[model samples]
Target: MKSIRKYMNLPGSLFLVTLIFAMSMTPVSASAAALRADIVQCDPNPAEIGQYVNVWIKIENIGNTRAEDVSVELIPSYPFSLDTGDDTVRNIGILSTDRHASLEYNLHVDENARPGTRSIKVRYQDDEGTAWNEETLNIWVGSGSDTFDSKGTIQLEQITIEPEVLMPGDTGTVTFTLKNTATQYSISLGGEEYDTNARIRSATLEGTDDITVKSDPYHDTGILGPGDNVELTYNIEVDDTARDGTKHLEFIVVGSSYTYNYKWDVPVKVDSAGIKVIPTKPLTIDNGVATIQFDIVNTNPNTLTSVSIRPQAEGIEFSPVEYFIGSMEPDELFTAEFDAQVVSDNISNQQELALIAQYRNGINQHETFLNDLSLTIVTEKPNSGTGLASISILLIIFVISSLVMYRHKKHQQ
Candidate 1:
């Protein structure tokens, strides 16, 4: 009885240990409101003392569930505080998953604020039962006096868009080369020497209805001394139904102070037209064989590469399989030919033959199908000997008519 009682207790102990181990192996759960905040736009990154600075913070809900009762509170520390009559917290209704909203805050710099980086606190709250989340943001404070101003100015030296022109439903990049136009490393203003350094706080490319920007905004790009230059590129996607015309994108660049901010309208062209395939000859099969010809035309406003045509049918065989046209310029046309043979007579000779034209537009491969084209199959004509016999009979009749005319003349004489 004692041994049996001990065995029963042993099974209970084992069960208890197993339960504890399983509980320890379980993973922790994450919050439903996965909120993230970023300072996308700061008009004047280096705030001037005794002046107001406009800050735009982008709040994004990265979680799968919607975040309700979203509120952003600006908690500025020393040297930075919300201006008078400005609310410290802004209540934004709801933020759906993967969606973002921008909150603007007006901050006033203290009269005695030192010229350097300062910290500010941002608090956001959602209805996830977890009260609030906080983030710290750093901003630059400029010297209030103009004697120590930034002498260099940033200019957009060049703009380049890949493929130059974008086709609808295409993804491309737009690059901008920014240069500090100051010639000297330092400049004297009001008998005071200041360094010709341009601090690039942020650069943002705003998209329109027809375009969607995929690249993140540039932040704290550091300093550009004198004539130094830097390049910024943004990835963009054109909508498939975008109209064919010139679309404008807003390019915004903020410098040392709000006074140095720059905005420009960058033009992007969209063309939805593509390559065309036209049959240059009658699509017919004679004697169970046919020579198919097509004129491949690049109707797009840009050049296309790797131009090729492939002919396919249910019971037909094509010579060369596919015709390759190396490259085609805008509005250029190239004729391609293929020898087709009817392998199966049962195949409806009058069926539509498929003409697939494949080409590349600015590194994007596209295919156009011409499947509604009708093809006719005509039986071979009668033997050549029959045609020869008909010609012989005509010649014999002509000769006999000439002899009869000659005999009639002799009888008359």
Candidate 2:
């Protein structure tokens, strides 16, 4: 009887222990997995100062089971300020998933905000109130470092132009003004260098493009404390092959910061340089010969164009009525001068002369000039040694006559 009672009691105790173990195995708490935050993008990708940015984040539970009542909080630091964009950056309040969904956040940075990499710590708690996981990220803002201290210190000049008109293959030049507001600045132009002594740095044509300009080997490398400026020159070239219409330098810049984008408007004009005459003024016509002045004013923004002048005179001799005026800017006056002596064999009542200039821009370097310049040199009666020579001979004869008469009178007296 004692042995049987022992066996039954042992079995009952085993059952109770098994039941207790199973109850204890039931899940009673939620486990917090690692927090993974991925940056989708900061649209306008590299954000500009005072510009709006859209950032997307991808969060994952990274746990075996789905998460419940998920929440994330973002805190901003210096230079990284957030504009109150309703619910864009605030807590999602609650979310649930084995993988966190991509949530978009809209933020705007102030114009005065500093530029740099910014990161936000992600904090969250599960429905069961477990431990929080966090991480950091390197956010990119601008393509280059934002030297706010250097901002407005270096600036380009304003470009202005008048009479927006031009002919095809025309060449001209535009001027721009820039200044350095900061105390010191170093400028690099076409591999050349320059420095400013004071804080205010100013440069003209600082950001013009496609000018093919080489800076003087001596650069502006002086320290600028404030309010200093330098003039920049761009040698413009209008391609003969350029379209007959308008030409543009789409992206000129003053500084890297967004606030000072005024440099984009630096003055630029294509095909606006006025007509260029091959041979410019001061043409002299010999007896019975006629000639005209030929010239060209740069009608577009191009470098000093080399020109050839061809003078033509029919029915009369033209003493090579041609010359070159290296280059001329828009609104500038130019004239070529040469003596137009007539050839011995020439005969015609009225004669016409032409002067032409030719050069290359891109392809098809063309020629243009003043044509059919009219000079009516009515044939003078056959000269009996006229002009200075005739006058000299007459004077000599008169002197001889006077001396002879005076001598005779003296002899008579």
Candidate 3:
């Protein structure tokens, strides 16, 4: 009876040992079936604001056993959003040992994303629904300047201004070039080959009070494909009262997928008109009458209209002192002449005369007065009168001598 009991107990103990060994091996087998995943690359390396990007991930079965029912997921956070709707999770199915699988996902970067490096969590699992590995990927986000679309598309290429130097009360045009720098390709979806189109919804211009936009701000450019470009134009006018300096103009470009805002400094220069009075000939006084000759010059870019000059001197009388110049174009010169008499004999040889210039800038038709113009008056040489008298007396004496000589010759005959 004891031997039989021992044999039964030994068999039962062996059976219990076998059961424990099998249970211990179960975890090892499960552990052998593991998955590891890493980010391969992300399209649009520097993600743009309010735009979609594609992220590619490479997964491999690094363990001895095969992984079944494999799945990958992205842990969402701020500045980064999932565009896959409820499908943030992807099923990779079966992955054999040392084999790899590539997965792609569509994600969106938020419009208010700060510019810098950001991280996102990626996770993977196997058939047993057990977590395998979690990875944190670093991505770069930009402020529209360095960002591009998934297909390497650039929306705003360049902006150009006509009449590079802008002046007050001047009208000009501005042009913006929209380009797509993407490589061309076609993908079949729903049994149809679909091509990508870059669509511009609107374009607008904002300027300061000194500048006015005459053209409509909004423009619709239908579509642009790979290596294609379009030019948009706007008309602008500068205010007459605008001062000369630097002004800014803001351009906003909106697309079906994104929006870009840019600012440019435009130089504003006001056309200036000036007046200068210069003597055309020597100013001289003869027999109490002073003859004045001068040239009035418009020394600036703007045209001057209704130009007139008035001359005044102390202790001197002027005949028709005010001269009408009519209209003067830019850099124009007008000749003027007048006569004046010294009211006092004590007037010096060099007299100081004040001349006032009155004209309109032609822009606003408002009169502008310049009162600082001056002229110099010089007296003629007193020796001129004495010399003329001497010559007259010599001529009369010669004529009398000739008449007497002729009469004496006739009497002798």
Report the number of the highest-TM-score candidate. 1
Candidate 3 residue lDDT tens string, 38-80: 6545555556777776776777777888888888888867788
Model 3 TM-score, 2 decimals: 0.37
The residue ranges of model 3 lying beyond 4 angstroms of the native Cα positions read 1-152, 185-196, 259-413
Which of the two candidates, 2 or 3, achieves a greater TM-score against the reference? 3
Give all candidates' CA lDDT scores: 0.84, 0.51, 0.70
TM of each candidate vs. truth: 0.69, 0.32, 0.37
- Which segments of candidate 2 are over 4 A away from where they belong? 1-155, 158-167, 170-177, 182-225, 230-235, 239-263, 269-310, 313-316, 320-354, 357-413
| Tens-digit per-residue lDDT, 189-209, candidate 1 | 889898899978789997776
On the 0 to 100 scale, the lDDT of residue 170 in model 2 is 38
Better of 2 and 3 by lDDT: 3
List where candidate 1 sits over 4 angstroms from the true fold. 1-37, 58-103, 109-148, 184-188, 193-199, 219-227, 239-243, 380-413
RMSD of each: 8.6, 28.7, 29.6
Q: Cα deviation of 325 in candidate 3 (Å)? A: 18
How do the candidates rank by TM-score, highest first? 1, 3, 2
